[model samples]
Target: MSFSIGIVGLPNVGKSTLFKALTKIKVDIAAYPFTTIHPNVGVVRVPDERLDKIAQIFKPEKITPTIIEFIDLAGLVKGAHKGEGLGNQFLAQIRNCDAILEIIRSFENPDVENVTGKIDPKNDIETIKVELELKDLEIEERNLSSPTKLLQSKSEGKEEKENLLSKKPIIYLLNTDGKTQYQVPKIKHLIMNLKDELEILELSDLEKKELGVKSKLDQLILACYNILDLITFFTVVGQKETRAWTLKNGQTAPEAGGVVHSDFQEKFIRAEVISWQKLVETGNWKKARELGQLKTVGKDYIVRDGDIIEFKI
Candidate 1:
Protein backbone atom coordinates (compact mmCIF):
# COMPACT_ATOMS: atom_id res chain seq x y z
CA MET A 1 0.00 0.00 0.00
CA SER A 2 1.09 3.57 -0.62
CA PHE A 3 0.38 7.08 0.71
CA SER A 4 1.56 10.53 -0.41
CA ILE A 5 2.35 13.56 1.78
CA GLY A 6 3.18 17.07 0.59
CA ILE A 7 5.97 19.04 2.26
CA VAL A 8 5.03 22.73 2.35
CA GLY A 9 6.35 25.86 4.00
CA LEU A 10 7.90 29.26 3.35
CA PRO A 11 11.07 29.34 1.23
CA ASN A 12 14.40 28.23 2.70
CA VAL A 13 12.78 26.53 5.69
CA GLY A 14 14.74 23.34 4.93
CA LYS A 15 11.84 21.75 3.07
CA SER A 16 14.17 20.61 0.31
CA THR A 17 16.79 19.55 2.85
CA LEU A 18 14.23 17.42 4.70
CA PHE A 19 13.06 15.90 1.40
CA LYS A 20 16.65 15.00 0.51
CA ALA A 21 17.14 13.44 3.94
CA LEU A 22 13.89 11.49 3.74
CA THR A 23 14.47 10.08 0.26
CA LYS A 24 18.28 10.38 0.11
CA ILE A 25 17.78 12.02 -3.28
CA LYS A 26 19.82 15.14 -4.16
CA VAL A 27 17.78 18.13 -5.36
CA ASP A 28 18.77 21.72 -5.90
CA ILE A 29 18.85 23.57 -2.54
CA ALA A 30 19.48 27.30 -2.49
CA ALA A 31 19.19 29.98 0.19
CA TYR A 32 17.21 32.43 -1.91
CA PRO A 33 13.40 32.48 -2.39
CA PHE A 34 11.50 30.58 -5.10
CA THR A 35 14.39 28.11 -5.54
CA THR A 36 12.10 25.17 -6.30
CA ILE A 37 9.58 25.91 -9.05
CA HIS A 38 8.22 22.39 -9.64
CA PRO A 39 7.76 19.79 -6.90
CA ASN A 40 10.11 16.82 -6.39
CA VAL A 41 8.44 13.51 -5.53
CA GLY A 42 10.12 10.59 -3.75
CA VAL A 43 9.15 7.46 -1.82
CA VAL A 44 10.39 6.34 1.59
CA ARG A 45 9.78 2.85 2.85
CA VAL A 46 7.73 2.42 6.00
CA PRO A 47 10.17 0.91 8.54
CA ASP A 48 8.64 -2.23 10.00
CA GLU A 49 10.54 -4.65 12.27
CA ARG A 50 7.73 -7.15 11.97
CA LEU A 51 8.55 -7.64 8.29
CA ASP A 52 12.10 -8.46 9.25
CA LYS A 53 10.94 -10.99 11.86
CA ILE A 54 8.63 -12.62 9.31
CA ALA A 55 11.48 -12.79 6.86
CA GLN A 56 13.62 -14.46 9.50
CA ILE A 57 10.95 -17.06 10.16
CA PHE A 58 10.03 -17.81 6.55
CA LYS A 59 13.37 -16.94 4.92
CA PRO A 60 11.47 -15.57 1.93
CA GLU A 61 13.22 -15.01 -1.37
CA LYS A 62 11.88 -11.47 -1.56
CA ILE A 63 10.78 -9.03 1.14
CA THR A 64 8.69 -5.98 0.45
CA PRO A 65 7.78 -3.26 2.92
CA THR A 66 5.10 -0.60 2.67
CA ILE A 67 6.08 2.86 1.40
CA ILE A 68 5.02 6.50 1.69
CA GLU A 69 5.54 9.11 -1.03
CA PHE A 70 6.63 12.64 -0.13
CA ILE A 71 6.30 15.60 -2.46
CA ASP A 72 8.51 18.67 -1.88
CA LEU A 73 6.53 21.70 -3.05
CA ALA A 74 7.72 25.25 -3.69
CA GLY A 75 7.22 27.82 -0.94
CA LEU A 76 4.02 29.86 -0.65
CA VAL A 77 4.21 33.59 -0.14
CA LYS A 78 1.54 35.88 1.43
CA GLY A 79 -0.43 36.48 -1.80
CA ALA A 80 -0.25 32.82 -2.83
CA HIS A 81 -4.02 32.70 -3.33
CA LYS A 82 -3.57 35.46 -5.94
CA GLY A 83 -0.97 33.32 -7.79
CA GLU A 84 2.19 34.97 -6.46
CA GLY A 85 5.49 33.01 -6.53
CA LEU A 86 4.35 29.72 -8.06
CA GLY A 87 1.37 29.69 -5.71
CA ASN A 88 -1.01 28.08 -8.21
CA GLN A 89 1.47 25.36 -9.10
CA PHE A 90 2.19 24.68 -5.42
CA LEU A 91 -1.52 24.38 -4.69
CA ALA A 92 -2.02 21.98 -7.59
CA GLN A 93 0.88 19.77 -6.48
CA ILE A 94 -0.40 19.53 -2.94
CA ARG A 95 -4.04 18.84 -3.91
CA ASN A 96 -3.06 15.33 -5.04
CA CYS A 97 -1.43 14.45 -1.71
CA ASP A 98 -3.29 12.48 0.93
CA ALA A 99 -2.18 14.88 3.67
CA ILE A 100 0.04 17.88 4.30
CA LEU A 101 3.35 18.00 6.19
CA GLU A 102 3.72 21.67 7.11
CA ILE A 103 7.46 22.28 7.64
CA ILE A 104 8.08 25.05 10.20
CA ARG A 105 11.51 26.59 10.61
CA SER A 106 12.60 26.96 14.23
CA PHE A 107 16.20 27.86 13.61
CA GLU A 108 17.67 31.19 12.50
CA ASN A 109 20.44 31.57 9.93
CA PRO A 110 21.62 34.93 8.69
CA ASP A 111 22.62 33.53 5.30
CA VAL A 112 19.15 32.25 4.47
CA GLU A 113 16.65 35.10 4.20
CA ASN A 114 13.28 34.46 5.80
CA VAL A 115 10.39 35.35 3.49
CA THR A 116 8.90 37.41 6.32
CA GLY A 117 12.38 38.85 7.22
CA LYS A 118 12.12 37.24 10.69
CA ILE A 119 11.18 33.79 11.98
CA ASP A 120 7.75 33.69 13.58
CA PRO A 121 6.62 30.07 13.34
CA LYS A 122 3.03 30.77 14.33
CA ASN A 123 2.56 33.56 11.80
CA ASP A 124 4.27 31.44 9.15
CA ILE A 125 1.79 28.62 9.77
CA GLU A 126 -1.22 30.97 9.68
CA THR A 127 -0.09 32.44 6.36
CA ILE A 128 -0.13 29.05 4.65
CA LYS A 129 -3.45 28.12 6.28
CA VAL A 130 -5.24 31.30 5.25
CA GLU A 131 -3.97 31.17 1.69
CA LEU A 132 -5.09 27.57 1.28
CA GLU A 133 -8.42 28.40 2.84
CA LEU A 134 -8.88 31.21 0.32
CA LYS A 135 -8.25 28.78 -2.53
CA ASP A 136 -10.81 26.39 -1.03
CA LEU A 137 -13.34 29.22 -0.89
CA GLU A 138 -12.76 29.86 -4.58
CA ILE A 139 -13.46 26.21 -5.32
CA GLU A 140 -16.73 26.42 -3.41
CA GLU A 141 -17.70 29.55 -5.31
CA ARG A 142 -17.17 27.86 -8.66
CA ASN A 143 -19.37 24.93 -7.60
CA LEU A 144 -22.12 27.28 -6.43
CA SER A 145 -22.07 29.07 -9.81
CA SER A 146 -22.99 25.87 -11.68
CA PRO A 147 -26.26 26.44 -13.62
CA THR A 148 -28.25 23.22 -13.14
CA LYS A 149 -29.05 21.53 -9.84
CA LEU A 150 -29.68 18.20 -11.60
CA LEU A 151 -26.16 18.35 -13.06
CA GLN A 152 -24.54 17.92 -9.64
CA SER A 153 -24.48 14.45 -8.11
CA LYS A 154 -25.02 14.06 -4.38
CA SER A 155 -21.44 13.05 -3.63
CA GLU A 156 -19.90 15.70 -5.87
CA GLY A 157 -22.22 18.38 -4.45
CA LYS A 158 -21.32 17.48 -0.89
CA GLU A 159 -17.61 17.41 -1.76
CA GLU A 160 -17.86 20.79 -3.48
CA LYS A 161 -19.45 22.30 -0.39
CA GLU A 162 -16.61 21.00 1.76
CA ASN A 163 -13.33 22.92 2.02
CA LEU A 164 -10.77 20.43 0.77
CA LEU A 165 -7.80 22.51 1.99
CA SER A 166 -9.18 22.93 5.50
CA LYS A 167 -10.39 19.33 5.58
CA LYS A 168 -7.05 17.75 4.65
CA PRO A 169 -5.21 16.51 7.77
CA ILE A 170 -1.92 18.23 8.66
CA ILE A 171 1.22 16.98 10.41
CA TYR A 172 3.46 19.82 11.54
CA LEU A 173 7.20 19.15 11.17
CA LEU A 174 9.40 21.44 13.26
CA ASN A 175 12.86 21.87 11.72
CA THR A 176 15.08 22.86 14.60
CA ASP A 177 18.68 23.94 15.38
CA GLY A 178 19.02 21.16 18.00
CA LYS A 179 20.29 23.62 20.65
CA THR A 180 17.32 25.85 21.44
CA GLN A 181 14.31 24.13 22.99
CA TYR A 182 10.95 25.41 21.83
CA GLN A 183 7.45 24.80 23.14
CA VAL A 184 5.60 22.14 21.24
CA PRO A 185 2.96 23.53 18.92
CA LYS A 186 -0.74 22.76 19.48
CA ILE A 187 -1.04 20.64 16.36
CA LYS A 188 0.37 17.15 15.85
CA HIS A 189 4.11 17.69 15.23
CA LEU A 190 7.62 16.24 15.44
CA ILE A 191 10.88 18.18 15.77
CA MET A 192 14.06 17.31 13.92
CA ASN A 193 17.29 18.86 12.68
CA LEU A 194 17.11 17.96 9.01
CA LYS A 195 20.51 19.38 8.19
CA ASP A 196 22.18 17.61 11.08
CA GLU A 197 20.44 14.33 10.30
CA LEU A 198 21.26 14.47 6.62
CA GLU A 199 24.89 15.11 7.44
CA ILE A 200 24.86 12.12 9.78
CA LEU A 201 23.56 9.90 6.98
CA GLU A 202 26.85 10.43 5.15
CA LEU A 203 28.91 9.19 8.08
CA SER A 204 29.96 5.63 8.84
CA ASP A 205 28.27 3.58 11.58
CA LEU A 206 30.94 4.42 14.16
CA GLU A 207 30.80 8.08 13.19
CA LYS A 208 27.02 8.12 13.67
CA LYS A 209 27.41 6.86 17.24
CA GLU A 210 30.01 9.53 17.97
CA LEU A 211 27.66 12.25 16.67
CA GLY A 212 24.63 10.67 18.45
CA VAL A 213 22.57 10.76 15.24
CA LYS A 214 19.66 8.39 15.46
CA SER A 215 17.49 8.54 12.34
CA LYS A 216 14.12 10.25 12.91
CA LEU A 217 12.52 8.71 9.83
CA ASP A 218 11.04 5.88 11.90
CA GLN A 219 9.49 8.30 14.38
CA LEU A 220 8.21 10.51 11.58
CA ILE A 221 6.57 7.55 9.87
CA LEU A 222 4.93 6.41 13.11
CA ALA A 223 3.67 9.91 13.90
CA CYS A 224 2.24 10.44 10.40
CA TYR A 225 0.55 7.01 10.41
CA ASN A 226 -1.06 7.80 13.74
CA ILE A 227 -2.26 11.20 12.52
CA LEU A 228 -3.78 9.58 9.43
CA ASP A 229 -5.39 6.75 11.45
CA LEU A 230 -3.66 4.04 9.42
CA ILE A 231 -2.93 0.39 10.18
CA THR A 232 -0.82 -2.38 8.63
CA PHE A 233 -1.47 -6.03 7.80
CA PHE A 234 0.88 -8.65 6.38
CA THR A 235 0.72 -11.40 3.76
CA VAL A 236 3.31 -14.18 3.38
CA VAL A 237 3.14 -16.17 0.17
CA GLY A 238 4.55 -19.71 0.65
CA GLN A 239 8.08 -18.62 1.60
CA LYS A 240 8.48 -16.81 -1.71
CA GLU A 241 7.47 -13.30 -0.72
CA THR A 242 6.33 -11.45 2.42
CA ARG A 243 4.79 -8.00 2.21
CA ALA A 244 3.22 -5.33 4.39
CA TRP A 245 0.00 -3.51 3.45
CA THR A 246 -1.59 -0.36 4.81
CA LEU A 247 -5.27 0.22 5.43
CA LYS A 248 -7.56 2.63 7.25
CA ASN A 249 -8.23 1.81 10.91
CA GLY A 250 -11.66 0.20 10.47
CA GLN A 251 -11.46 -1.18 6.92
CA THR A 252 -13.04 -4.61 6.33
CA ALA A 253 -11.35 -7.80 5.10
CA PRO A 254 -12.50 -7.40 1.50
CA GLU A 255 -11.46 -3.75 1.51
CA ALA A 256 -7.98 -4.79 2.56
CA GLY A 257 -7.95 -7.39 -0.21
CA GLY A 258 -8.77 -4.70 -2.76
CA VAL A 259 -5.51 -3.03 -1.73
CA VAL A 260 -3.61 -6.14 -2.82
CA HIS A 261 -5.54 -6.82 -6.04
CA SER A 262 -8.84 -5.81 -7.63
CA ASP A 263 -9.95 -9.38 -8.31
CA PHE A 264 -9.17 -10.39 -4.71
CA GLN A 265 -11.95 -8.11 -3.46
CA GLU A 266 -14.52 -8.98 -6.20
CA LYS A 267 -13.99 -12.74 -5.87
CA PHE A 268 -13.03 -12.72 -2.20
CA ILE A 269 -14.14 -15.69 -0.18
CA ARG A 270 -13.29 -16.34 3.48
CA ALA A 271 -9.99 -14.96 4.78
CA GLU A 272 -7.69 -16.84 7.14
CA VAL A 273 -6.70 -14.51 9.93
CA ILE A 274 -4.18 -14.66 12.76
CA SER A 275 -2.43 -12.04 14.80
CA TRP A 276 1.30 -11.65 14.06
CA GLN A 277 2.08 -12.43 17.69
CA LYS A 278 0.09 -15.65 17.54
CA LEU A 279 1.83 -16.72 14.35
CA VAL A 280 5.23 -16.03 15.91
CA GLU A 281 4.32 -18.06 18.95
CA THR A 282 3.16 -21.00 16.84
CA GLY A 283 6.30 -20.77 14.69
CA ASN A 284 4.54 -21.70 11.43
CA TRP A 285 1.18 -21.46 9.63
CA LYS A 286 0.52 -25.23 9.84
CA LYS A 287 1.15 -25.33 13.59
CA ALA A 288 -0.84 -22.13 14.07
CA ARG A 289 -3.85 -23.72 12.35
CA GLU A 290 -3.40 -26.96 14.27
CA LEU A 291 -3.44 -25.02 17.53
CA GLY A 292 -6.58 -23.12 16.44
CA GLN A 293 -4.67 -19.83 16.36
CA LEU A 294 -5.95 -19.19 12.84
CA LYS A 295 -9.59 -18.54 12.16
CA THR A 296 -11.66 -18.02 8.98
CA VAL A 297 -13.13 -14.54 8.80
CA GLY A 298 -15.71 -13.20 6.37
CA LYS A 299 -15.89 -9.90 4.53
CA ASP A 300 -17.36 -8.22 7.60
CA TYR A 301 -14.23 -8.86 9.68
CA ILE A 302 -12.50 -5.59 10.47
CA VAL A 303 -8.80 -5.67 9.62
CA ARG A 304 -6.60 -4.89 12.60
CA ASP A 305 -3.02 -3.66 12.77
CA GLY A 306 -0.37 -6.39 12.59
CA ASP A 307 -2.86 -8.94 11.32
CA ILE A 308 -1.47 -11.79 9.17
CA ILE A 309 -4.01 -12.71 6.53
CA GLU A 310 -4.51 -15.22 3.69
CA PHE A 311 -7.28 -14.45 1.25
CA LYS A 312 -9.19 -17.25 -0.47
CA ILE A 313 -10.74 -16.29 -3.77
Candidate 2:
Protein backbone atom coordinates (compact mmCIF):
# COMPACT_ATOMS: atom_id res chain seq x y z
CA MET A 1 0.00 0.00 0.00
CA SER A 2 3.05 2.24 0.29
CA PHE A 3 4.96 3.51 -2.76
CA SER A 4 8.23 5.40 -3.07
CA ILE A 5 10.40 7.04 -5.74
CA GLY A 6 14.14 7.56 -5.44
CA ILE A 7 15.75 10.76 -6.74
CA VAL A 8 19.18 10.09 -8.22
CA GLY A 9 21.72 11.70 -10.50
CA LEU A 10 25.39 12.59 -10.81
CA PRO A 11 27.02 15.10 -8.43
CA ASN A 12 25.45 18.59 -8.41
CA VAL A 13 22.58 17.78 -10.78
CA GLY A 14 20.10 19.37 -8.29
CA LYS A 15 18.99 16.14 -6.67
CA SER A 16 19.01 17.71 -3.21
CA THR A 17 17.53 20.96 -4.52
CA LEU A 18 14.71 19.08 -6.20
CA PHE A 19 14.06 17.20 -2.99
CA LYS A 20 13.94 20.45 -1.04
CA ALA A 21 11.54 21.94 -3.60
CA LEU A 22 9.20 18.93 -3.72
CA THR A 23 8.94 18.20 -0.01
CA LYS A 24 9.73 21.68 1.40
CA ILE A 25 12.31 19.96 3.56
CA LYS A 26 15.65 21.65 4.17
CA VAL A 27 18.62 19.51 3.18
CA ASP A 28 22.34 20.09 2.62
CA ILE A 29 22.77 21.56 -0.90
CA ALA A 30 26.23 22.40 -2.06
CA ALA A 31 28.18 22.84 -5.29
CA TYR A 32 30.27 19.75 -4.53
CA PRO A 33 29.82 16.00 -4.69
CA PHE A 34 28.45 13.81 -1.86
CA THR A 35 26.56 16.71 -0.27
CA THR A 36 23.92 14.16 0.53
CA ILE A 37 25.87 11.21 1.89
CA HIS A 38 22.83 9.82 3.69
CA PRO A 39 19.51 9.53 1.93
CA ASN A 40 17.04 12.33 2.80
CA VAL A 41 13.48 11.06 3.11
CA GLY A 42 10.20 12.99 2.89
CA VAL A 43 6.60 11.93 2.36
CA VAL A 44 4.71 13.89 -0.29
CA ARG A 45 0.95 13.88 -0.64
CA VAL A 46 -0.23 12.66 -4.02
CA PRO A 47 -2.07 15.59 -5.65
CA ASP A 48 -5.69 14.79 -6.44
CA GLU A 49 -8.28 17.46 -7.34
CA ARG A 50 -11.00 14.80 -7.20
CA LEU A 51 -10.43 14.44 -3.45
CA ASP A 52 -11.00 18.15 -3.00
CA LYS A 53 -14.26 18.06 -4.99
CA ILE A 54 -15.56 15.10 -3.01
CA ALA A 55 -14.73 16.81 0.25
CA GLN A 56 -16.61 19.91 -0.93
CA ILE A 57 -19.77 17.86 -1.50
CA PHE A 58 -19.60 15.73 1.64
CA LYS A 59 -18.45 18.54 4.01
CA PRO A 60 -16.50 15.94 5.94
CA GLU A 61 -14.84 16.70 9.26
CA LYS A 62 -11.57 15.30 7.91
CA ILE A 63 -10.00 14.58 4.55
CA THR A 64 -7.02 12.36 3.90
CA PRO A 65 -5.04 12.05 0.69
CA THR A 66 -2.84 9.17 -0.41
CA ILE A 67 0.91 9.82 -0.24
CA ILE A 68 4.23 8.71 -1.74
CA GLU A 69 7.72 8.98 -0.27
CA PHE A 70 10.62 10.57 -2.07
CA ILE A 71 14.22 9.82 -1.15
CA ASP A 72 17.15 12.07 -2.13
CA LEU A 73 20.10 9.75 -2.54
CA ALA A 74 23.81 10.49 -2.93
CA GLY A 75 25.02 11.16 -6.43
CA LEU A 76 26.55 8.36 -8.53
CA VAL A 77 29.68 8.72 -10.61
CA LYS A 78 31.53 6.73 -13.29
CA GLY A 79 32.92 3.41 -11.96
CA ALA A 80 30.15 3.59 -9.37
CA HIS A 81 29.48 -0.11 -9.77
CA LYS A 82 32.94 -0.70 -8.32
CA GLY A 83 32.22 1.57 -5.31
CA GLU A 84 33.34 4.82 -6.89
CA GLY A 85 32.03 8.00 -5.10
CA LEU A 86 30.06 6.06 -2.49
CA GLY A 87 28.24 4.30 -5.30
CA ASN A 88 27.56 1.04 -3.50
CA GLN A 89 25.72 2.74 -0.65
CA PHE A 90 23.78 4.97 -3.05
CA LEU A 91 22.82 2.05 -5.29
CA ALA A 92 21.72 0.01 -2.29
CA GLN A 93 19.42 2.85 -1.11
CA ILE A 94 17.59 2.98 -4.46
CA ARG A 95 16.77 -0.73 -4.68
CA ASN A 96 14.00 -0.35 -2.09
CA CYS A 97 12.24 2.29 -4.17
CA ASP A 98 9.42 1.36 -6.56
CA ALA A 99 10.60 3.82 -9.23
CA ILE A 100 13.43 6.22 -10.06
CA LEU A 101 13.53 9.94 -10.90
CA GLU A 102 16.85 10.66 -12.57
CA ILE A 103 17.98 14.28 -12.75
CA ILE A 104 19.82 15.17 -15.94
CA ARG A 105 21.58 18.55 -15.90
CA SER A 106 21.34 20.66 -19.05
CA PHE A 107 22.12 23.91 -17.31
CA GLU A 108 25.60 25.39 -17.59
CA ASN A 109 26.94 27.21 -14.54
CA PRO A 110 30.65 27.65 -14.08
CA ASP A 111 30.12 27.92 -10.33
CA VAL A 112 28.53 24.50 -10.07
CA GLU A 113 31.09 21.85 -10.96
CA ASN A 114 30.02 19.12 -13.38
CA VAL A 115 31.60 15.86 -12.31
CA THR A 116 31.44 14.54 -15.87
CA GLY A 117 33.20 17.76 -17.08
CA LYS A 118 30.58 18.42 -19.78
CA ILE A 119 26.90 19.38 -20.07
CA ASP A 120 25.92 16.73 -22.58
CA PRO A 121 22.54 15.23 -21.58
CA LYS A 122 23.00 12.16 -23.80
CA ASN A 123 26.35 11.20 -22.31
CA ASP A 124 25.15 11.95 -18.81
CA ILE A 125 22.18 9.64 -19.23
CA GLU A 126 24.36 6.93 -20.66
CA THR A 127 26.78 7.17 -17.76
CA ILE A 128 24.00 6.72 -15.20
CA LYS A 129 22.36 3.90 -17.17
CA VAL A 130 25.59 1.95 -17.62
CA GLU A 131 26.39 2.21 -13.95
CA LEU A 132 22.94 0.97 -12.96
CA GLU A 133 23.12 -1.92 -15.44
CA LEU A 134 26.58 -2.91 -14.22
CA LYS A 135 25.43 -2.85 -10.61
CA ASP A 136 22.46 -5.05 -11.45
CA LEU A 137 24.75 -7.46 -13.26
CA GLU A 138 27.01 -7.56 -10.20
CA ILE A 139 24.05 -8.42 -7.98
CA GLU A 140 22.87 -11.10 -10.42
CA GLU A 141 26.32 -12.67 -10.45
CA ARG A 142 26.38 -12.84 -6.66
CA ASN A 143 22.89 -14.36 -6.58
CA LEU A 144 23.94 -17.07 -9.05
CA SER A 145 26.80 -18.20 -6.81
CA SER A 146 24.62 -18.42 -3.70
CA PRO A 147 20.98 -19.01 -4.52
CA THR A 148 19.97 -19.14 -0.88
CA LYS A 149 21.30 -15.61 -0.38
CA LEU A 150 18.26 -14.31 -2.26
CA LEU A 151 15.83 -16.42 -0.22
CA GLN A 152 17.42 -15.24 3.02
CA SER A 153 17.31 -11.68 1.77
CA LYS A 154 13.60 -11.94 1.03
CA SER A 155 12.89 -13.45 4.43
CA GLU A 156 14.62 -10.49 6.06
CA GLY A 157 12.66 -8.06 3.84
CA LYS A 158 15.93 -6.56 2.60
CA GLU A 159 15.55 -7.57 -1.05
CA GLU A 160 12.88 -7.74 -3.68
CA LYS A 161 12.14 -10.71 -5.93
CA GLU A 162 13.11 -8.66 -8.96
CA ASN A 163 16.44 -7.10 -7.92
CA LEU A 164 17.52 -5.51 -11.14
CA LEU A 165 17.82 -1.72 -10.83
CA SER A 166 17.56 -1.24 -14.60
CA LYS A 167 14.25 -3.13 -14.62
CA LYS A 168 12.58 -0.52 -12.39
CA PRO A 169 10.49 2.27 -13.88
CA ILE A 170 12.51 5.46 -14.51
CA ILE A 171 11.60 9.06 -15.28
CA TYR A 172 14.29 11.42 -16.52
CA LEU A 173 14.05 15.08 -15.49
CA LEU A 174 16.11 17.52 -17.54
CA ASN A 175 17.15 20.32 -15.21
CA THR A 176 17.30 23.18 -17.67
CA ASP A 177 18.29 26.86 -17.64
CA GLY A 178 15.21 27.67 -19.80
CA LYS A 179 17.50 29.45 -22.30
CA THR A 180 19.68 26.76 -23.79
CA GLN A 181 18.47 24.37 -26.48
CA TYR A 182 18.98 20.69 -25.66
CA GLN A 183 17.87 17.62 -27.53
CA VAL A 184 15.09 15.89 -25.67
CA PRO A 185 15.66 12.21 -25.08
CA LYS A 186 13.18 9.66 -26.42
CA ILE A 187 12.08 8.46 -23.03
CA LYS A 188 9.77 9.51 -20.19
CA HIS A 189 11.15 12.97 -19.41
CA LEU A 190 10.23 16.44 -18.13
CA ILE A 191 11.98 19.84 -18.20
CA MET A 192 12.24 22.40 -15.43
CA ASN A 193 14.68 24.69 -13.71
CA LEU A 194 15.17 23.49 -10.15
CA LYS A 195 16.61 26.81 -9.00
CA ASP A 196 13.69 28.75 -10.43
CA GLU A 197 11.20 26.35 -8.86
CA LEU A 198 12.87 26.64 -5.48
CA GLU A 199 12.79 30.43 -5.67
CA ILE A 200 9.03 30.45 -6.24
CA LEU A 201 8.29 27.91 -3.54
CA GLU A 202 7.66 30.60 -0.93
CA LEU A 203 5.53 32.76 -3.21
CA SER A 204 1.75 32.96 -2.96
CA ASP A 205 -0.38 31.58 -5.80
CA LEU A 206 -1.24 35.09 -6.96
CA GLU A 207 2.39 36.14 -6.83
CA LYS A 208 3.41 33.09 -8.83
CA LYS A 209 0.83 33.89 -11.52
CA GLU A 210 1.93 37.52 -11.65
CA LEU A 211 5.52 36.36 -12.13
CA GLY A 212 4.46 33.83 -14.83
CA VAL A 213 5.81 31.00 -12.71
CA LYS A 214 3.90 27.73 -13.02
CA SER A 215 5.04 24.76 -10.98
CA LYS A 216 5.58 21.42 -12.72
CA LEU A 217 5.90 19.45 -9.49
CA ASP A 218 2.24 18.44 -9.71
CA GLN A 219 2.70 17.17 -13.24
CA LEU A 220 5.82 15.32 -12.10
CA ILE A 221 3.87 13.62 -9.31
CA LEU A 222 1.14 12.62 -11.75
CA ALA A 223 3.77 11.21 -14.07
CA CYS A 224 4.94 9.01 -11.22
CA TYR A 225 1.39 7.66 -10.98
CA ASN A 226 1.31 6.92 -14.71
CA ILE A 227 4.68 5.14 -14.69
CA LEU A 228 3.54 3.01 -11.77
CA ASP A 229 0.19 2.19 -13.45
CA LEU A 230 -1.75 3.36 -10.39
CA ILE A 231 -5.36 4.44 -9.91
CA THR A 232 -7.19 6.26 -7.13
CA PHE A 233 -10.43 5.44 -5.31
CA PHE A 234 -12.38 7.14 -2.51
CA THR A 235 -14.23 6.29 0.68
CA VAL A 236 -16.80 8.54 2.36
CA VAL A 237 -17.65 7.74 5.99
CA GLY A 238 -21.04 9.42 6.33
CA GLN A 239 -20.47 13.05 7.38
CA LYS A 240 -17.26 12.22 9.23
CA GLU A 241 -14.55 11.75 6.62
CA THR A 242 -13.76 11.39 2.91
CA ARG A 243 -10.40 9.82 2.05
CA ALA A 244 -8.49 8.85 -1.05
CA TRP A 245 -6.70 5.53 -1.66
CA THR A 246 -4.41 4.24 -4.38
CA LEU A 247 -4.30 0.82 -6.03
CA LYS A 248 -2.77 -0.85 -9.04
CA ASN A 249 -4.70 -0.35 -12.28
CA GLY A 250 -6.22 -3.84 -12.51
CA GLN A 251 -6.48 -4.65 -8.79
CA THR A 252 -9.76 -6.18 -7.57
CA ALA A 253 -12.22 -4.99 -4.90
CA PRO A 254 -10.83 -7.15 -2.11
CA GLU A 255 -7.33 -5.84 -2.73
CA ALA A 256 -8.66 -2.29 -2.50
CA GLY A 257 -10.47 -3.12 0.73
CA GLY A 258 -7.24 -4.52 2.09
CA VAL A 259 -5.62 -1.13 1.54
CA VAL A 260 -8.20 0.41 3.87
CA HIS A 261 -8.12 -2.50 6.36
CA SER A 262 -7.39 -6.22 6.32
CA ASP A 263 -10.72 -7.32 7.76
CA PHE A 264 -12.62 -5.63 4.93
CA GLN A 265 -10.76 -7.81 2.46
CA GLU A 266 -10.96 -11.05 4.45
CA LYS A 267 -14.71 -10.86 5.33
CA PHE A 268 -15.56 -9.40 1.92
CA ILE A 269 -19.08 -9.44 0.57
CA ARG A 270 -19.96 -6.71 -1.90
CA ALA A 271 -19.24 -2.98 -2.46
CA GLU A 272 -21.65 -0.10 -2.94
CA VAL A 273 -19.93 1.94 -5.61
CA ILE A 274 -20.64 5.16 -7.45
CA SER A 275 -18.44 7.36 -9.52
CA TRP A 276 -17.41 10.53 -7.64
CA GLN A 277 -18.72 12.73 -10.43
CA LYS A 278 -22.18 11.11 -10.35
CA LEU A 279 -22.38 11.41 -6.58
CA VAL A 280 -21.33 15.04 -6.77
CA GLU A 281 -23.88 15.72 -9.54
CA THR A 282 -26.78 14.11 -7.67
CA GLY A 283 -25.88 15.92 -4.42
CA ASN A 284 -26.19 12.92 -2.05
CA TRP A 285 -26.36 9.13 -1.76
CA LYS A 286 -30.17 9.04 -1.80
CA LYS A 287 -30.35 11.09 -4.98
CA ALA A 288 -27.67 8.95 -6.65
CA ARG A 289 -29.57 5.79 -5.73
CA GLU A 290 -32.80 7.31 -7.01
CA LEU A 291 -31.12 8.02 -10.36
CA GLY A 292 -29.86 4.39 -10.47
CA GLN A 293 -26.26 5.52 -10.49
CA LEU A 294 -25.19 3.36 -7.55
CA LYS A 295 -23.70 -0.01 -8.42
CA THR A 296 -23.21 -3.12 -6.29
CA VAL A 297 -19.99 -4.97 -7.11
CA GLY A 298 -18.60 -8.24 -5.82
CA LYS A 299 -15.03 -9.25 -4.99
CA ASP A 300 -14.08 -9.56 -8.66
CA TYR A 301 -14.77 -5.87 -9.31
CA ILE A 302 -11.76 -3.93 -10.53
CA VAL A 303 -11.64 -0.56 -8.78
CA ARG A 304 -11.43 2.48 -11.02
CA ASP A 305 -10.19 6.02 -10.58
CA GLY A 306 -12.63 8.41 -8.90
CA ASP A 307 -14.88 5.61 -7.65
CA ILE A 308 -16.55 6.28 -4.27
CA ILE A 309 -16.82 2.87 -2.66
CA GLU A 310 -18.52 1.61 0.51
CA PHE A 311 -17.15 -1.81 1.36
CA LYS A 312 -19.44 -4.50 2.82
CA ILE A 313 -17.70 -7.05 5.00
Q: What is the lDDT of candidate 1?
A: 0.85
**Residue clash pairs of candidate 2:** none
lDDT of 1 at 209: 84
lDDT of 1 by residue, 16-124 (tens): 9988988989898998988888899999888999888877879999999988888989998888878988888788787888788989888888898877877667778
TM-score of each: 0.94, 0.95
- The TM-score of predicted model 2 comes to 0.95
TM-score of 1: 0.94
Native-structure RMSD, model 1: 2.0
Go through the candidates in order and give the clash count of each: 0, 0
lDDT of each: 0.85, 0.90
Give Cα distance to truth, residue 9, candidate 1, Å: 0.6
